[model samples]
Target: MMDKMMATLLESLHEATQRLEQAVAVKESNPDDWLAILDEREELIHQMQERFSAGSVLTEAQRVQLTQIYEVNQRLIPLIEGCKQGVQQQLNNLHRSKLAMNSYNEAGPNGYGAFFDRKK
Candidate 1:
């Protein structure tokens, strides 16, 4: 029984992680889709949390399996955080690029001297 519960909890955790990843992907591809994914992710995470808490009653083997899950999650969390940061950085860079492109477009290619001009 406890083994089955632990398995279910692990599966839930995996699903939640997948949902989170999908949300990140959707946000990158289509910003408007992010809200929906966020909603789903929240729901899945809540479910996973409930099951994980209940998994405290697991037996020795199940406990070991749970510990392994924890270790894997610990390793994965930093990578996930890094991925999120990378995505945010990419978005920031893209925004800056767009702004720079617009500014240059407005100023014309010959406007390079605008920066070096000594006139106040």
Candidate 2:
């Protein structure tokens, strides 16, 4: 029974990893679509956490697969970080441009001023 549970969890983990990788690729071209992938990944993670909390024993093969998953995650971390940084940079640029436009659009001292009666 434990072996079967472990196998199922392992399969889910593999599927999540594959989906995440696909998301990473799609993120550059179609970021909106990537959001749905992230949602699915989040749910898979929750399910995996529940299984771990249930304290199921695993066979040696399952342990090896888990280790492989860990290794794959290690590789994925940097790619995800790069994607995050790119998104942040885009946001910063957008904010700066918005500020610049607001400054340009502001009504700057129309010809008549409070000081007009005081001096040349």
Candidate 3:
């Protein structure tokens, strides 16, 4: 019974990771979807931890599955980081553009009066 429960949790974790991988593959995937998958995986990990703490032993097959999951996670790190950098770059560009627009607005016709004295 414990073994079956562990197996089911591991399978769910595996599927979650695969879904995350697919989400990452898309250039325009939503970060929320990635977060959702990570949340599901976290829950599975917690459940598995509880089972292990309750004295469940891992079968060889379960160990292999865990190893594969770890590898997939390792591969995902760089891709996720790349996505993060891309998002950060976009934000930076947006901030710069906003600043430019603000400067332009401030320098319009209203700003020129400040450079000259009305008494002159």
Q: Give all candidates' CA lDDT scores.
A: 0.60, 0.71, 0.88
- Worst lDDT run of 10 residues, candidate 3, spans 111-120
Query: Model 1, residue 11: what's the lDDT?
Result: 62
Over 6-120, each residue of candidate 2 has an lDDT whose tens digit, in order, gives 5786778777777767667664456566567667767766876777788867678778877877787787789878877888999999999999766654635436443222222
Model 3, residue 6: distance off in Å is: 0.7
Write one digit per residue (lDDT tens) for candidate 3, span 6-109: 99999999999989999999989999999999999999999999999998888888889899999999999999999899999999999999997777666545
Model 1, TM vs. native:
0.50
lDDT of 1 by residue, 29-117 (tens): 55445446456646755765776676645567656755765665576566557766887999999999999777655653455455432
Best by TM-score: 3
Give the candidate order by descending TM-score.
Answer: 3, 2, 1
Clashing pairs in 1: none
The regions of model 2 sitting more than 4 angstroms off are 26-42, 108-120
Order candidates by lDDT, high to low: 3, 2, 1
Q: Model 1 off-target regions past 4 Å?
A: 1-56, 108-120
Candidate 1 local distance difference test against the native: 0.60
